[model samples]
Target: MTAKVTLSFTDETIEDARRYAERDGMSLSAWIDQAAREKALRELFNAHADVVRRAGHDRLEKHALDDAREVEMVRSEFRGRRAAQR
Candidate 1:
């Protein structure tokens, strides 16, 4: 289902969009619709990520952090061993 809505744009912008639509072989409405849908989906995913980040750190987050710490420790140990061998 779809509905038609009127929108206003500057003459220059309208011309630009019209040319873009033509180059892509689509109607102006279709071009705008695709752009709007892509932007909407991106915003929706970012919002979901924000909610997850705010929901409180849990076991999964802690485990990832712990893994990173272990990796750093191993790298530091290797550096120390290399320095000793030099």
Candidate 2:
């Protein structure tokens, strides 16, 4: 069972939402629902990341170094893309 809800937005926001809805081939309500779900998932991931960072890692020297190197490579690639755009 579902209950109906009313939402209000500024004209510009409504236009943007309509555009996004058309792009996704969904009704504005469906598009908003999908966007909300994605946002919730991202927030959950961010919360998990904080917990993982606090715990720290216990690992062998070689394995730890390899993991760090992989992370560095990804960071550098992301930075390079950002730098190119600027």
Candidate 3:
């Protein structure tokens, strides 16, 4: 599903986004949407990392990526279970 939204951006920001969209071979809307999605995913990942760290399972250098992946997988399963119940 796609939505048409009205958003306001400054001239400089618009120009920068246009340049990036052209460089990436995407429409302006698509570029903006992709950027927004990436930012959201980054925040979600960071939130998960904070939870893991607070739980005293913060990653060691050798397995940092693996630990993050495991956390993500576990979180995904938990989300799935909740969805099923609802």
Q: Which candidate number would show the highest TM-score if scored against the true structure?
A: 3
lDDT order of candidates, best first? 3, 1, 2
Model 3 has an lDDT value of 0.74
The regions of model 3 sitting more than 4 angstroms off are 60-64, 67-86
Checking candidate 1 for backbone clashes, the offending pairs are: none
Please, what are the lDDT tens digits per residue for candidate 3 over residues 44-83?
8688677778888764533765667866875685565435
Clashing pairs in 3: none
- Residue pairs of candidate 2 with colliding backbone atoms: none
Candidate 1 regions exceeding 4 Å error are: 56-86
| TM-scores, all models, native as reference | 0.56, 0.61, 0.71
Against the unseen true structure, what C-alpha lDDT does each candidate score? 0.68, 0.66, 0.74
User: Candidate 1 or 2, higher lDDT?
Assistant: 1
Prediction 2 global C-alpha lDDT: 0.66
Query: Residues 6-67, candidate 2, lDDT per residue (tens digit)?
Result: 98989999899999888766777766766665577568656756665666743343464467
Score candidate 2 by TM-score against the native. Answer: 0.61
Tell me the number of clashing residue pairs for each predicted model.
0, 0, 0
**Higher-lDDT candidate among 2 and 3?**
3
Query: Model 3 — which ten-residue stretch has the worst lDDT?
Result: 77-86
